[model samples]
Target chain A: MPTVELRFAALNGHVRTARMIATAVSRCAGVPAGAADEIKLAVTEACARAVRVNRRHAPQSPVHVALTETPDSFTITVADRGQSGDEVAPGPDGGLVTASTLLDLEPDSAAPPWWSEPAEEESEADGGFPPGLGLALIEGLVDEVQISRGADGVGTIVAMTWHTGPAVAPSDSIL
Target chain B: MDLSLTTRQEGNHTVVVVGGEIDVYTAPKLREQLIDLVSGGSYHLVVDMEGVEFLDSTGLGVLVGGLKRVRAHDGSLHLVCTQERILKIFRITGLTKVFPIHSSVEDALAAHE
Candidate 1:
């Protein structure tokens, strides 16, 4: 397996750079061209999520992204130094998430058009999008996704995997 | 490219022409503009994103926010986007059922006309 590591400050500006890198690295790793946009969008979402938490809790910490390529697939791991919560499980092998949760992402169209905290609705803080939206998008973009604790068991690690095979359209989630 | 927002009027709809990528960083800017547009009393909106090269969840959040704001006034917010890449996000998030999406600004402006 070959891997490329990128460590940058948790800033919104770097998210686009990370997306571009994911695209280039995917092509080099034999990921299909059809999946390039999905990879780019997924990488941006993961990095943006990392940047968001890091800015809130660990302003000095950096977002760690490891892009790995194997004969079977390519994996993008985005880790943040912010405090990890119940949202994370054990190690990747010990606990994994069911991407099926993505299917219910927008079940109630009658609900709020965007996600928001009932308590914070009056606070005007970023208008409260669902914390799971990012993960939902990543799961939709990749072949497999795992949300686990970081190496030191302190922060969160989101590992998104994409196979170097026939393209899987993100729209398939609608099917 | 960075985000560039330009607003124009068409009939009763306010068309916001969005170009470039709308990710986390730029999404805030878009949100502010949308809020201002609604605050300025323009309820019906048509967001033209034909030039948007990329859109992430954050951008979607802003669009949703805009929708809710307009809907509060019993108005509508229509989206003008034809790109498969951009439409894929809406499909994956199941937002296609929430907002009316049109392929052209003309169609969006003429949505309820």
Candidate 2:
């Protein structure tokens, strides 16, 4: 099983390239074409999170992505150089984040008629930009998700793994 | 530019045709377009995403923002998306309930009538 590591500037523009490369690697690793879109979307979400984390904390560090192919799964690890002390980050213990936990995205908060109320502060932070759905979407797309601190205890690492099989139906629950 | 945006008017509905990838890098363009349309008085929005090849949370956020903007004026944001890959995002984020998703631009336009 070969592994490929990519380092790109912590910029949103590079997130697409990262995802494209990840999708290409996933295909080469025996992931079905039907699952390519899931890989693409998952990589995009992970890299975008890294980009934002880097921008606010480690502007000079590049976002790191490691795509690895194993006998049973294809895994992508998106790591950021940003420091800890974040509000939304998982615990320092780097606990495994279950799909149910991230599902607290509280879809209803973004629902109509009421999204404009309690979600106003969230919208204001981005100057009216909608709240992000990265992790929740990732959970839906990938087979397994793990969030933890980097080995050097520096930044966050989001590792998403998808089983190498025929294909996972879009309607299939990844949870 | 990973995203392309084009706007057309159809029977009182503003059909925004979006193509290419809608990720963090390109979602802002769509957001700006939606904001301009809402503030400029085009409320009944029908976003045609049939040509979209990719979308992520940023894109989803932009759509949510657009919906909020329009709803401010008692307007509606109907999405025209047929791609299963893309639709999965809406369903996962539970946006399918928040937005009236149609299969085609004509269907969205007709529903807006």
Candidate 3:
């Protein structure tokens, strides 16, 4: 179980890289291809959410993605600097909540979308949640999603976990 | 990924079997192909996805777009999804509700009547 750290802007290329990392993790962990894709989508959404939140402080800040695999589970963490209201608050539960909603799991009823469309006046206050359905999709696919804030308001950490199940060898072909 | 679109007459329906990943980068190709089928007065489109192993949001958008175009042309679009992964995506996005899906190409053809 080695860890891979990837730092990049929340760009399209990193989305593909997140997928590749998921495939690699699944290959190494002996998971099914579909499961791997689900993991990849969840992690990619989390990273994108982090970048969206970071836009308030450092719009161009490079988001950091860490993929770590253990014997029993694989964890992908997306981190970026931003402070919501509580400096000592845990990682963005709202983000994880969005991810869970995508997975069809119930998060806090009051939680809003992770990323919202930029509003005319609110754009200066903070990029309020962008109205989209991505977070809900991520939540539906991932098993356990958690959010934790750093001690010094350095960043928010969104972690997604996929547990090892009955090993399904990758087939030679998808179809 | 290689996508080949061919029209085969199954009684009164035209079946177009697509073979490849229908994603964002490749969806435009699918859009073009579907547009040709519709604009050329070719209706009764049945997409055979036996060879499609993967699909993403962009791909789904293209399919939705195709559905809209086909509807406007007074035609219908059907799907032949045999691949589990692809089917799963359809089901997750509730696309199975939007399009008619059959177990196989033969089933799709038979159901058209």
Candidate achieving the largest lDDT: 1
Better of 1 and 3 by lDDT: 1
lDDT (Cα atoms) of all candidates against the true structure: 0.78, 0.76, 0.62
Q: How high a TM-score does candidate 1 get?
A: 0.86
Model 3 chain A scores worst on lDDT over the 10 consecutive residues at: A122-131
Q: In candidate 3, residue B14 scores what lDDT?
A: 77
lDDT of 2 by residue, A1-175 (tens): 3399999999889998998799779878987666788888889888988888888899899999999998778999989987753324342356433232343435454433444433242353332332234665676777888877889999988899988754544434231
The residue-level lDDT of candidate 3 at A10 comes to: 54
Clashes of each: 0, 0, 22
Query: How close to the true structure is residue A167 of candidate 3, measured as C-alpha lDDT?
Result: 60
Candidate 3: Cα lDDT at A46: 63
Question: Which ten residues in a row are the worst by lDDT in model 1 chain A?
Answer: A113-122
* TM-scores for every candidate against the unseen true structure: 0.86, 0.85, 0.64
lDDT of 3 at B109: 76
CA error at residue B52 for candidate 3, angstroms: 1.4
Q: What is the DockQ score, from 0 to 1, of model 1?
A: 0.43
Q: Could you list the chain B TM-scores for each candidate?
A: 0.98, 0.96, 0.90
> What lDDT score is found at residue A34 in candidate 2?
68
Q: What C-alpha lDDT, on a 0 to 100 scale, does residue B3 get in candidate 3?
A: 55
Task: Give the lDDT ranking, best first.
Answer: 1, 2, 3
